[model samples]
Target: MSFQLFGLPVARGVAIGRALLVSSSRVDVAHYYIEPAQIEAEIQRLRMARDAVVEELETLQRELPGDAPAELSALLDVHVMLLQDELLGAATKQWIAERHYNAEWALSAQLEVLARQFDEMEDEYLRERKADLEQVVERLLLVLSEGGGGRGRAGGLPQLSAATGDNPLILVANDISPADMLGFRRSVFTGFVTDVGGPTSHTAIVARSLNIPAVVGAREASRLIRQDDWIVIDGDAGLVIVDPSPIVLEEYRFRQRSGELERERLGRLRHTPAVTLDGEPVELLANIELQSDAEAAIAAGAQGVGLFRTEFLFMNRNGELPGEEEQFEAYRGAVMAMQGLPVTIRTVDVGADKPLDRLSIHELRQEQGLNPALGLRAIRWSLSEPSMFRQQLRAILRASAHGPVRLLIPMLAHESEIRLTLEMIDRAKQQLREAGLAYGEVQVGAMIEVPAAALMVEAFLDRFDFLAIGTNDLVQYTLAIDRADEAVAHLYDPWHPAVLHLLHHIIRAARKRGKSVCVCGEIAGDIDFTEVLLAMGLRSFSMHPSQIPALKQKVLRTDTRRCSVLRPARGVPD
Candidate 1:
C-alpha cells in the first residue's frame, strides 16, 4: 500500500530509493545484575566502549571533507566532549560498581536521570539539548553491544550489496546523530527522513551541505516503513512516500529530472551578473555564520558577505565565550579571505531562542515569562553588557584594518539604542587609537527586523550607513508567530499581506532616503520570490551560499520594468 508522510523541509531536492529503516528502539537495554566479582570486568568494558566511541568520533572529525559545512566539525567536537564528560565516564562506572548492574543498563539509567533533569529546564534551547544527551548515550550503548567493531551492519545501517540494483537507499530513522551521518560518508544513501530535528539542527545543516534530500521531523517515519520498501523523498515539499505506486514513482522521477535540469541551468549562470533587462545591476551577497563559509561565498560568486552572523562563535564553547583575540582572528581571517569584498559582521545577537548559558544575563531569562523573543536580545543585550560588547567591537575594529568591514547592529527598535551603539563603536575606535593600533574605515549598519524599526525607518536612515531587512524575524514578529515552533510554522508566512506591506515600506523608505538596503533572509534566497523582490525595488539580496546561483539565474532573466507593472491580482507566478 502507498502512504504519504509530511515533515519539515530542511534541504531541497528529490530522491527515489529503497527504504533503509533504522530502529529507534535499538538502545533499549535489559537490566541485569552482575556478581561483585565481575564488576571490574564490566567497568573495563564500559571504559573501552567510551574510548572506542571517542576514537571513532575523532577519526570522523579528522576525515571530514574540507568542503563540508564548518558546523559539521563543531558537531563532532560536541560529541567528543560528551564522550569525555566526567559524568558519563566516572559516574557511569560508579553506578556499575555500586549497583552491580551491566554497563549498558547503568548507562541507560544515568541517561534517563539526566534527560529528566534537562526536560525540567526552563530555557527552551537548553531543553532541546536533551536530544544531544540521548544521541551520545545511544552511541555508547551501540558500541557496548557491538563490541566496539566500529558501526557497520550491527549498528543498523544497511550494507550495500554488489549484486543489488542501482536504486538509491533512503535512510529512515527516529533521529540521526551527526556522528551517524558522518559514518555513512562511505555509503551510497541518496537521502534521509527522520522523525526528529528542526531546520536549524546540526543534522539539517550537514544535510544541506552534502546537498542531500532530507525531510526531518517526520513523526513515525521509522515505524511506518520497513527495510527494502520502495520510498520517495520530495525534500523540496517535505513529503515522504512509502511503498509508492508506479504512477507516483514515475511522477516523482519526472520531477527529479526537472529539478536536476533546473540546477544545471542555474549552474551555467555561475559567473553571470545579477542584472535586470533594464540594465539595473543588483548586488548578490551571501549570508554566512562561520568564518570558513567565506570560501563557499567566493565560490558561489557572492559580491561580498551581506550578513556574517557572529553567534556561532559563542555557541558550543562549554560556557566559555570567545575572547577578543579569538574573535579578532576569526574576523580578520574572514576579511582577509574575501580579498577586498565587504564583510558585514553583526555582533552577538543572542537571547531568547539563542541563550548564552555562561552569561549572567541569560540567568534572568527564567523570569521573562513564556515569551523570550520579545525580551532583551541582540543590541539590547549587548548594550546591557558593555564589557562583552566592547570586546566584540574592538575585535571587529582591529579586523577592519585587514579589509573592507561593516559593523551591523541587530534588533534595533529605538533611536536611543542606535545612538548608544554608535557611541560604543566610537568608544571602541578611541581605545584602538589610544593603543596606537591602526584600523580601516568601518561602515555601520542596522537590521530592519523589528516592526517598530520598519515603521520608523526615517529616523534610522540618517543614523546608519546601510540597512538590511531580515524578513525571517520581521515576519515572525509582525504575524505574532514563533517561526521555530512547528505548531505555528504554517502561520509564519513571508507572503503575508502585512509582511509584504512592511517590506515594501522599508525598501521604499531606504530608497527615498538614498541609502542602500539589502534583504538578508530566507526570502532573499527563494527563487520564486526573486522577481517580486526585484520589482519591489530590492537591488541587493543576501542569502545562503548554496542559494546564490539559482537566485542569480532569476535575476538575470527578470525584466524589472515589466515585473513592476504586474500585480498580485494579475495572477503573477509566485
Candidate 2:
C-alpha cells in the first residue's frame, strides 16, 4: 500500500531506502527502592556513571572530524554540563539518601521534575531543552544499568547498520540526539526523519552540514514506520512516501538523478564570481548561525558573512546568559575564521518567538494577551535593557579588533531607536577605550525588516553606514501573516505587490544614499526572485551556504539591464 506523510523540509535532497526505526531507550528505565545500607553504594554508582558519560562524550568530541561543524562540539559541551549539573548531581543524591531509592530511580525522579519544569516553559526553544535533559539522564541510567561498561546500544543506530547489508537505509525516530547521529556519521544511512524538531533545530543543522536528506516534525513517523519497510524521503518537498509503489519509486529515481546532475553542474561554479552577464559584480555572502557555518560559507565561495545571527549562542543551555567574554570569543572566532572577510554580527533578536528564560523579560512574557512579535524585541528590547545591550556591544567591539566586523541592529523602526542604539555603541566604545583596549573601526548597519523601518529610509540612511533588508519578517508584517503559523502560511506571499513595493523602495533608497544594500532573508536565496531583485538594484545577497552555488548560477546568467527593461508591472505576470 502507498501512503505519504508531510513534514518540515529542512535539508534538501531525495532518498529511497528501507526504513530503520530507532526507538529512544529513555522510556525503558527500571525503578526501585534501595535499602539503607545500599544508599552509599548507590551514590557511588551515580558518581561513576556521571564520570563515564563525561568520558565518553569527551572521547566523542575528540573523535569528531577535524572539519566537523562547531555546533557538534558545542552540543557535546552542553551534554557534559548537563551530566555535571549541580541539580542532577546534588538533588539526585539527596533523593537517594532521603527517599531510599536506588541511583537509577533517584536520577529518574529528578529527571521527571526537570522535564516538568522544561515542559512548563512557554518558549518552544527552551521547552526543547527537556529532550536534552532526558538524553543526559538516559545516558546515566544506561551506564548505571550496564555496570558502567557498555555503550548503551548507540541509540539503536548500530542495528540499522547491521540489518541493511550494504543497502541504504532511512532512519526514522521520535528524536535523534547529536551523540546518536555522530555514532552513525560513518554509516550507510541515506536520510533521516524525526517526529520532533523544527527547521532551526540542532538535528536539522547537523543534517544539512552532513548533506543528508532530512524531514522533521513528522509526527508519529517512528510509530508508523516498521524496520525494512520501503520508504521515499523528499527533503525539498517535506514528503515521505511509505511502501511506495513501482510508479512512485521510478518517478523519484528520475528526480534523484536530475537533482544529482544539477548539483554537479552547480558544484563546478563554486569558484566562479557571482557576476552578471553584463560584467557587473555582485557581492554574494552567507548568513551564518554558527562558527562552523563560516567554513561552509567560505567553501561555497561566499565573499563574507553578511548576517551572523548571535541568537544561537543564547539558546539550548540552562537558565543562564552567555557572559561578555563568551560572546567576545564567539564573535572573534567568526571574525578570525572568515580570514578578514567582512562579518556582520546582529545583536540578540530574542522575543515573541524566542524568549530567554534567564532574563527578567521572561517573567513578563507570561502575561496573557501579549503579542511577542510586536512586543519588546530586537532593538526595542536592547534599548529597554541597557546593561545587557552594553555587554553584547562591548563584546562585539572587542571582537572588531580581530578583523572586519560590522554591527547590524535588528527590527529598528524609529529615529529614536536608532539614536539610542548609536548612543549605546558610543558608550561601549568609550568603555573599551577607558580600559585601554584596542579595537578596529566597525561599520554600523541596520536591518530594514519592520514596515516602519522600510518607510523611514531617510532616517536610517542618515544614520547607519549600510542597510540590509530582512524580507522574511518584512513580508510577514506587511502581509499581516505569521509565516510560522501553518494555518496562514499559504497566505504569506513574498511576491505580493506590497512586499515587492517595499523591497523596491528600500533598495532604491539605499542606492540613492550611496550605501551598500544586501538582502539576507529567505527571499535572497530564492532563485526565482534573483532577477527581480537585481532589476531593483540589489547588488548584494546573503543566504545560507548551501544556497549560494545555485543563486550564483542564476546571477551569472542574469542580465540586470535586460531584467530592468522587461520587469513586470504590478499584478501582472512576467
- Cα RMSD to the true fold for all candidates: 13.5, 13.8
- The digit string of per-residue lDDT tens for model 1 on 47-101 reads 8888888898899999998999998898889888878888778888876787565
lDDT (10s digit) by residue, model 2, range 219-270? 8787666555799999999999999989989999999999989988898888
Clashing pairs in 1: none
Candidate 1 — which residues are off by over 4 angstroms?
Answer: 15-212, 222-231, 242-261, 357-369, 567-574
lDDT scores of the candidates, listed in order:
0.80, 0.80
Off-target runs (Cα >4 Å) in candidate 2 are 7-11, 16-230, 245-254, 357-370, 570-574
